[model samples]
Structure formats: C-alpha cells, structure tokens
Target: MKRYLAYYNENHCENRNYDVVIVGAGIGGLYTSLMLPKNLKIAVLSKKDIYDSDSCMAQGGIAASIQDDNRKLHVEDTINAGCYVNNLEAVNTLVDESEEAIESLIKLGVNFDRDLKGNFYRSFEGNHSIPRILHVNGDSTGKGIMDALIKEVKNAPNIEVIPNVFALDIIEEDNKCNGIVAYYKDKFVYFKSRQCVMASGGIGQLFSKTTNADILTGDGIAMAIRANVELDNMEYIQFHPTAFYSQDFDNKLFLISEAVRGEGAMLRNSSGKRFMKKYDNRMELAPRDIVARAISHEIDKSNSNCVYLDATMYNRDFLKNRFNKIYSECKNNGLQIEKDYIPVIPAEHYFMGGIKVDLYSRTNMTNLYAVGECACTGVHGANRLASNSLIEAVVFGKRAAGDISKRINYDFEDNISTINTRNNPPNKGRQEFDVDFLKLRIDLKKLMDSSVGIIRNIDKLQNALNFVDEVLFKIENLKFNSVLDAEVYNMYLVARSIIESILNTKDSIGSNYVEEYSRHSVV
Candidate 1:
C-alpha cells in the first residue's frame, strides 16, 4: 500500500496515498478509522464537513444487551422484528460484540448519561423489551457521540480527515478494489489504497421527504453497483413512524424520537382517539414497521395528511428533561411539547440493504469492505428494530478494522495485475449549472414518493422501474461539472436499484408492504 502511494504520487499528479481509504466521516467510518492500527496511514473522506452526516442527525439512542444472559433476548427481539428473516449468525455477532463496542466508545471519551450510582442510564425505544438503549445528553445522542469521535479522529496522527471530497467511483483491477476516484478541491484525484471501506450512509435523499441529510445521495451504493458488487433487499426501506409534519416540501424532516413514544406518548387520530390498539397490542411501543404501517392506514382511513402524537399527558418537567432537543425543535417550529399535539407522519428513514457482506463486513470484491447503512449483512433483514442501526455500525466498523489489520501486509502483486484501471480526468471547461437537471431531480423524487414509497404493488413497482430506466439513460448522457450533477446521477442509479429490487420481491413483509401480498400473513 505504501509503495502504491509513492508510485501514484510520483507518476500521477495526486495528493497522497493511504493504507486504507474510508468514504464517509460518519460514526462507522470514524470508528473504523480509529480502530485501525495507528502505524498505518488512513484517509477519511467526507462529502461535506464531518458533522454533515445522517449519523450526527440521529436522535434515538444506541441499543445493547447490558445484562448478563440477556443476549438471547436481544437477538430474539431483533429477529422477531425483522420478521424472522434475519441472518442468525450476523445478528448474534452484533449482539455479542455490542458491549465491547460501547466500552470502546466510552474509552474514546464518549460521555454517555449515567446515574448517581455511576451506571449508564439506558432509555427504552420502540420494540426494545428492556431499557437498554444508551443515550447521552438526552435526545442529542448522535451529536454527543459525533463530537467525541470527531475529536478523537482529529487527534489521531495517522488518520487524514479530508472534507468536501466526493468519491465518484471505486478503482478496481482483477476484481480487487485498489482505491477511489474522487472530486476534491476542484480536481479529480485518484486516492490509492490497499483496502477501501464504503461507510457512506443510506439512500434516503432519493425520496421527496426524508430524515436523512442532503449529502446522502447513495454514492457508495451506486459506485458498488457499477463495480458489479452484490446487493440485497433494497426494497426494505424503513419509514419512521413519527416525523414532525411541517407541510413543507423539504428533504430534512425533524424526527420525533421513538424515545418519546417509549415514554408513554399516545398515537391519536384526527378525532383525538387512540388508534394503535386496532393494529397491534403493543400500541406505540410496537416495532417501527407496524407503527409506520398503522399510522399510514389511519391517515388513509381518515382522509388526513397526518396524525397526532400526544405527549402532553406526561409531566412537563419530565418531558423537558428527557427530550430537550425535541422540545426545543418543536418550540422553534411553533409547537410546545407539553401543550400542543405534535402533527406527525411517516417518512423514509432507514435503508436495511446495500452491498452484501459477511460476518467480517467484507464485500465479495476483495480488498473492499462496507459497514453502516450501506452494507447489508442481513442483520436487519426485512426491518430494523429501533436503535439497532448505531450499534450495528459500531460493531461492524470495529470488525472490519480488525480483519483489515490482520492482512495489511499481505502481498497483492497478483491481484494488482488483474485490475482494469480507468481514469476520470478533471473537467477542463467550466460547465454552467443546468436548470433542467434540477427539475429532473425533483421529478425523480416525486416519482419515488408516489410510486415506490411506503405502500407498493406490482403495477406501482413496474411504473417506478420504467421511470427510473428512462431517467437513468438520460443521466448517462449528461456531463458533470458540479457536485450536484454527480449527486443527481447517483440518485438515478440508487432509485433504479431500489425499484429493481422491489419489482423482484414478491412478498409483503416488514416495512415493504406489497398490496398483492397484503393478505398473506407475515411470520
């Protein structure tokens, strides 16, 4: 890896080389970078600043089985929530390693909330049988964890943090990933590395309304597809049960944390009547797929755009203390947590599938790994239990680091010879931003929201696939000069992949509800 770096720097006009290249500065990428051997050079790339990621926007806590012998229960809950389609081995790996992951975070200076007795304060979330979801600063869990990890990453001498770098594609030779081709600092740069990890979060931006950050345009998934990497279960998009409905057409939606529901909030219809009992006995505490589907059904029956989450029944002081971030956000939006009924609706929240990987988080392509939301290890299966995402990221991130460290010195001369290299040269002439491209992107989002959203059927899936095919062809002919152009192209690829996956899947399970299979019972 060091030799490749020197060769690239001397032969091609490039910045530098690294032993490992991690795309995305979120929790998974940062954790993996921190876990790697300190002697090896690593580069962490971010599309924007480090803080601009879905990981930092997460408000829910991280789940773990803290009690002795409770790992069985945790695994059971996860598999049950996934409709029994979860990979048992991968789920066990996640649950078994969760304690160590939390300890690693704490050792890295993460200040999780604790009680007077010095035990960690764990909160409950939807589908969690116990109060094992660890948080920090109340509802500001993601921000707290991100701040600590960013600090540690900056202090690590061996890791190079590069911001505003958009990875366009992975450079492959002989079925091995060598590095990435990225646009950075107004030039196309080739970053050579022996191992490449794709932790670039989800594909939520493909929808019209989502809780994901604007930068998540599915670049990692698209690049992987172009490289012929295997993908799985793209149809299982989790719609968060309660995103604050602002009635505005925007991608960024304020998430009303499931912690609020866990604390006894009621899901009420427009007539001020509780309705979740009609769907499931667990009510608001049910898993996300059930809650989201129930909420959607309620909205359809009442002919309303949204429902209400009534948390006012709780003590005012308790509400404020437990969810200060949510309280402040609601107040800023002209609603009071203790007085007004929060208008909420389901929105695209989590992607349970991406480049398929194994127990070690290694993709089929050699020298390549994927962790976080971009990798489908089959732990999530058809639906992700609440708060499992963060823990999965941390656990697999560490696993990927450990596996790479064991083979960092392995000879790759034969693999290097089998690679077919392609160069993406920097743009010479300045290309003006095209308004038509912006309109096309908007149209694509609307199409996904209407045809490929929460509820689907064969006809709808086919229509979505057709639209994606047409738009993708047009996108291939367009030239890119700005990050938005590349992002739009990636969005097209992501949308097509998702639609294709949905069309191939014939059953309704978990978050993916196809009308034809609606009568078939799940699990």
Candidate 2:
C-alpha cells in the first residue's frame, strides 16, 4: 500500500520512443506488458504500487473450460447468463481462450488448488453446469496469481513499470491516440507512444458497498469518454448477492465469495425463511442478477437491515481449512461462522458496462485500446458471471498486445509544449503541486457511493449526474499540478462517464435496477 511521489519531465528521458504506453499496473496491464514482443518498448503506468488493484482483491478463482469441457457449451452458458445480448464473436474468443489463459498462468508458476488424484481441482459457481473454475489456494486465488505475474514482470526486459504515474487524460491527436499526459510527481509529464492501452479496472469504489480496491474508480473509462469513446450499457452494474454486513462500519459490507453457495450455503431472512426459494427455483445457485434482485425484494418486504448466510451445512474442519480467510475475519469481528449465521446483504461489486472496445481491444478511438473490467467488450451483457473478470482481463490483454504488435509505429511531433510550472524547474517542480487535492477526492468518492449505489431510480441518478457534472466543471477550472490533481481529475472524469452512461440506459436489467423504468428491453 505504499504510495510514491514521482515527477515527469518534458525533456530528460533517454527512452521516450515506445510502441505502447499502458495506463494501469493491474493483471491486464501487467499481462500485456509481459506478453508483448521483447523487442517492442512498453511502459506501464500506475497511480500507486503495482499490486494495489482489484485484481489482487479478487477472492474467487478464474473461470475457464479445461478438462473434458466443450467450448460451445461454455459459450452457450455465457450467452444465456448474459441474457443473449453478448456479442457472439467476443464470447467465442473469450471462451476459446480460457484454457490457454489458464495454461499460461500455470506456466507462470501459479499454484492452483489440486485434488487428491493430482488433478487441477475445479469448482462450480452459480449458473454453471460443470465444475469449470480453477481456483488457487481456495479464496486467495487472485492474490496467488497476481504475486506470480508481478514477479515475472519485474524481470522482464522490454517493459518499464512506472508506479505513481497518474494518467490525467489520453493524448489524442487528429483522432488517434498519441500517448497519455500523466503527472509523474508534481510535474505534468507527457509520454508519447504509438499505442495506448487502458487496463484501469472498474468503478466499484464509487459506491458505498463494494469488494473492489480503492483504485477501482474507472479512471481509464473516464479518460476514454473524455476522448469521446463509445460506452455501452453503462447502467449494468453487478451487485454480488451477499456481502458480510459489518454493523461496526455502518453496514459497510465485505465479500463472502459465491463459492460458499457452490458449497451449499443458503440465504435466510430474519424470520428464519429461505427467501431465495420464493424468488427463484435455483435458490442460492441462481445467477447474481436474480440473486441480488431477490435479496433486494426481500429487504424491501421485511424492512430489515440485512439478510443472513447460513454456512452451518459445511463441517467445522472444512470451514476452517477451506474458508480460513472468511472464518478468521468473522471471528475477529466477534462472530463465529460455525455457530452464528453471517449477517449479509447485497452490495455493489462489478460494473458490466464501460468504454466499449472491439474484439481486438480497440475502442472507438483509433489507437486507443482498453482491456480488463474498464472496457466493455459486450461479453458480459446484463450480469457478469461468477469468475469471468480475471479471464476477460487476460484474454483481451493478449489480443490487444498481439494487435498492437502488428500496427505501424506512431511518431509524435517535436513541437509539443509542456505545462507551465515553477516548483523545481519545469521537470521536478511538478512534484511540488498541492497534495491536498487528494482530500477533495475523498468527497467525490462519497458522492458516487451515496447517489449512484446499488438501487437507482430516475431522480437519484439525475441528481448524481448533476453533482458529477458540477464536479467535473470545478475540476476543469482549478489550478493544480500533476500528482494528486491529475489523479483526482481522472477519477472525476470516470465518475461522470459512468453516471452519464447509467442515465442513458432506460430499462432495469441485471444489477442495474431502475425503479421508474419497468421494461427490461435492451436496445
């Protein structure tokens, strides 16, 4: 969680000629960085330490079809789960690449959970017909995978991972991405590359309850919108059915993985009722959209603070060994999982809409590419499946890299003007800009969480958009340097992009429940 301070100079860099400049250090960005051709110059930018991202915070395993599974069935399940709105080409590509991505991970030394027969163990998640999810160390799959990738990336030759580099906006020239204008420290530094990839994750942190890291504020999505990139289904935010409700943090919830349901955990209400059965026949095994809506419906009817997840079906040994993280966290909070039922409720988790990109990861902008959760490839239409987030990041990250390698090189004009600053020459003074801008940022996050959270109607969304529009205007009018100012500006842009997108979609579908619009039709 260490935050570094850096300054970018308009002039003093030895290696300014790069083929690609990526604006995130998460798995997607890092994977692209590593998979890229060794001869091509690549730079990865991050606002904080590389590992400080939602990729690391992910608790579930990566979903893929490996042993004896059919890609056609996988595609069918994905399309069915997404309510048939998925782009078949993209779905096929993602489904087809799942095994390769899993094998790639294993080649990178990722220690996936294994069975007694010495096979790669898989588990079943909601809506999946088979045990296709390949987990690592139970609930710590993401952490284990991220650690391996980071180690491999650090030793890579052609990649430069620049942490604490905040990408303010995409530098688009003549309708093509030239590079990005990022503040490295207090100074506004410009990196001109032919290709720019945004793997900047999601907007979960903008809400009150989420399982994402704080860095998941839709930065890349915002920057793309500022550059006029097309965003699809912005309102399709996926709220996980049950999060461990914390009474201590004013009901701030933490994730209790869907795998618990796969292992037979049931959802119960205050009156000791298994309410999910009343909503869907699948009960706890229903898709996240149905599960979340059912829970929301129950809460409305009961007028209760939250629901409960009964994990008593599993034995104590299984709970302690398999779900150690969930067990310990609950115990530390003065609740025992084996005895007391875990208090829970649905919370904002994943956003299924973002800067729309094609199968090659190219967005509407000519040279700009987007991957990870930040880019909407029309793969997850209404609701994202249980563990497809990590898979999508890897699959698209690879495609973007492969496509970028075949493109012609971009050359920036030498007459680029630098931002005016006087704290330590034009270069180092950029680091001296006011850090208090980060405080204003906290206020922006509060606004998003309060207004644009799980359940939204017309009035709340319009109000949220109005506030965000004003904030964006204020940000444009402010005098600030590269460091915190750039990051805040980027966040504001992403917030507005998401809010605006959510406002445009009329119907209530999936995680996006619009009370005023009763229709579930998709345009």
Candidate 3:
C-alpha cells in the first residue's frame, strides 16, 4: 500500500497552517469545531460541498435517553444490538452523555419534533425497548441538524469550511500526526496543524447498493489504516433491512428509515405474506442485523428480487405528515405509501468497525482523533442500533473537543504554523498512466456487492480479496490525474479491510455473516 497517495514536494507547495485541521465537514467535525475554543484556528476540509456529508441524508432522528434512568436501558439495548461484544466503557460514555448531546444540538438551533404539550415525541425503532428516537421535520432529521450546524459553523470566526478538498493521507512526522495532504482546487496543498481529526464518514461507495451518500469513500479509515492506527472491528458492516427498491437514483439507494416500521409498518414476502415471524419473534421490531438477515433469507427463499413493506394501514394524512419524504418518494414511483405495499430490499447501510479510538475519541496516534463513522469506539460493537449514529457524532465530538481543550499548548502554535515556510505555489506533479477509473470503480463496487455483501462465504471472500489485490497491483504504479485515481485505491483498501476481517473472524455474528455450512460455522 502507498503510504502517501500524494506526490508533493513540500519545499515548493501551497502550504497553509492551522491550529487544528479536521478532514471532514460532517456533523462530527462541525460539532467538534463548534465545541472547540473560539481562539483556535480550525479548518474543516470537505471532499465536496460543505453540506454534502452523509449526516444531511439521515432520515431517522437521534436516539437518546431522554426519559428517567432510561440511560441504563439505552446502554443495555445498545449492547444487545451489538451482541454484547461492545466496549463497556465506551457504551457507558455514549449513554451518560446522551442528554447533554441533545441539549447541545437544541441550543445550537436544532429544532426537534415535539407534541402540543411541548414534550418531545419519541419514535420507536428496532433494538430499542421503548420509543426514544427524536426526529425533526418528520423525515428530514439529518438536514435539520446539519442546517443548524452549518449556520453555527459559518458564523464561528475560527472555523473555515473548505469544500472540494479530498484528503488523501494523514501526514505524520516522527510518529505523530501533524497535518494532512490533500488534492484541493486542482493542486496538492499541505494543511499543517498542531492537531488533526479524521471524521471522513463511511465506506458505502465500496458497494454497488448502499444507503450512503456518494461522497462517503472511506478516506479517513483508509488513511488511518495506512498510518498503522489501531482498528478494532473492521468487519462489522450494517446493512439496513429496508431500502426503497428502485433503479432511478444514482449510485446511492434511497433509504427507508427504520422509523417507518417503528410507526407500524410490516414486512411481507413476495407472496404478500408477513414473513418476519419465521425468522425472529420481534418481527419488524427486531434489531437491524436480525431484520436485514431475515430480509436476505426471505429474498432467497422466495427467489425474488425484493420484499414488501406493508404500510397500508395508515391514512393518507398520517402518512404524509409522519413520513412526508417517504410518502412522496413512493408516490413518484407509482406506489402510494398509505395504501400500497412498498417494495423494499436490504442495502449496505452503516459501518460499526473502523479506526479504533478510546472513550475520548482519540485514536492510537497522539494529537489525532477519529470521530463519527470512521472511528470504531466500540459502542456499536458488531452492529449499530437505530438512530444512534447522530447522537454518537455529537456526544463524542464534544468529548474530543473537551480533551483537546486541555491538551492543546498555545505556545507551540506560533512556530508550527511557519515551520516549513519556503513559499511558492505547488506544481502539478507528473501525470502517469490514466487507467479507466470509471470502469474500475464500477467493477469494484459490483465485486464488493457480490462477494463482501450481506451474505458471504469463505470462498467468495478469498476470491474477492484476490480480485482487490489484482486491482491494487494494476494501479500501484499508475499516476493520478484526478482524485478518482486516489479514491479507487482507498476504496480497495477498505474492501480488503472488511474482507480480511471477515476471514479472520471464524464465527458469524451481527452483520458479518458467512454461509452456515460453507467451511465457517454460524454462531
């Protein structure tokens, strides 16, 4: 693997400095920037538009222990969803700071939904014993919180949100992370800083069918792996049980939020018979891993391409108001959600394992933090519970900021800012072989979907690994013209990480499943 995907001569490059550099502009990075001291100069480098992160696409609400000592139950439910292999301390912190996280968002102008009495309406989702998921604008929870965060971030004088900057590698000198190398504005720029955080979202683009934004390319996790940072559970990828079955969208699949089922939707097989009972007792309300596996099995048993989500019991008014986005999407596709059986299929959703971090969201490397989907803090263990991702970003993002507050030495900022100052604009490095990246990316996604997808076997995993290695071998010496060249390598690294982790794990658990009788025993 190439340690640095960039070809930069630091002696003559467009170099800039900051007190802290965040490699993503998602909710985690934005919240971290907001929580940090106002005096610090922070730069949030985004791969695309500032608001293009997956956080804005989230439809379900953030989960928190709003009711009485539901904190204990929340922790229990989270652990249960992950099959009890979660880090006990990390889970405790996530639960303990639940209320504080929600309060922080509210104070920052995030308006969650509440009833006439002003009590927050807690919706139910799989794995939770009771209703605790908080939403805004019915189904636009991600956009709601992101709009508020973007406003706050823009107003904060110390934070700079730079779009169109694709972070290629974590820059380390003498075993300490000090900055990042990225492709920005058609040239390589070095962003040097005292501290750096990698919040660069999920690895969904590796699969052909995913409920993640296309911008999510696993850049953070890939760079961390190359840097030898400790990664905990790289194999625990969560596949959502219900994504709208359609081919109209781009590479991204439209997610059917778990909140739909939480509000009384039912799952049916191709024969239009409710089929979840044969798989689990909780039926539509089971944990995400259970539900996804159940759907996969049903699809196989019926030899059908999709199953049905029966939400026909609700009135049109209720459906429109409660699930306005979903209702409209279904209608546009010729299915009225209020009276039609919506076609659904399981799709790649979330990643539970990534660069390992402590309770404070600090990775193994000093002065480097990995927050959000990129950091495997172990709260989710084998699989993540519904709506916990949004809460995790803020709860731990605040902690990361708090930890940095005490550790940041203001005296060192002056010298590090101008350490390597020989100022000249960077040259576009040698453009080598231009491989067919478009075709390569398409094939890679299809390979991952077929081999490393929801259901897996030892032979398929090994074959997939070999295929990834072959692709990497082909591109190992190729030169780059666009960020896509570097992104494909990152994608392959993430796929290899997931597949290797699965091969090492002998037992089937959570979302990482292997064929029951195909050389690996199912747990």
- Most accurate candidate by TM-score: 3
Per-model CA lDDT versus the true structure: 0.85, 0.77, 0.86
Report the lDDT of model 2 for residue 183: 62
Clashing pairs in 1: 173-419, 174-418, 174-419
Candidate 2: pairs in clash: 6-184, 6-185, 185-431, 186-430, 186-431, 187-430, 187-431, 424-429
- Candidate 3 pairs with clashing backbones: none
RMSD after CA superposition, every candidate: 4.1, 5.0, 3.0
Models 1 onward score TM values of 0.93, 0.88, 0.95
Q: What clash count goes with each model?
A: 3, 8, 0
Q: Mark the 10 consecutive residues where model 2 has the least summed lDDT.
A: 1-10
RMSD of 3: 3.0
Candidate 1 lDDT over 321-437, as tens digits, reads: 889989988888898878899999998999998989999899999999999999999999889999999999999999999999997765554343321334422233323445477
Name the candidate, 2 or 3, with the larger TM-score value. Answer: 3
Q: Supply candidate 2's per-residue lDDT for 313.
A: 79
**Per-residue C-alpha lDDT of model 3 across residues 271-304, encoded as one tens digit per residue:** 9999888777888989888888788888887899
Using TM-score, rank the candidates from best to worst.
3, 1, 2
lDDT for 300 (candidate 3) = 84
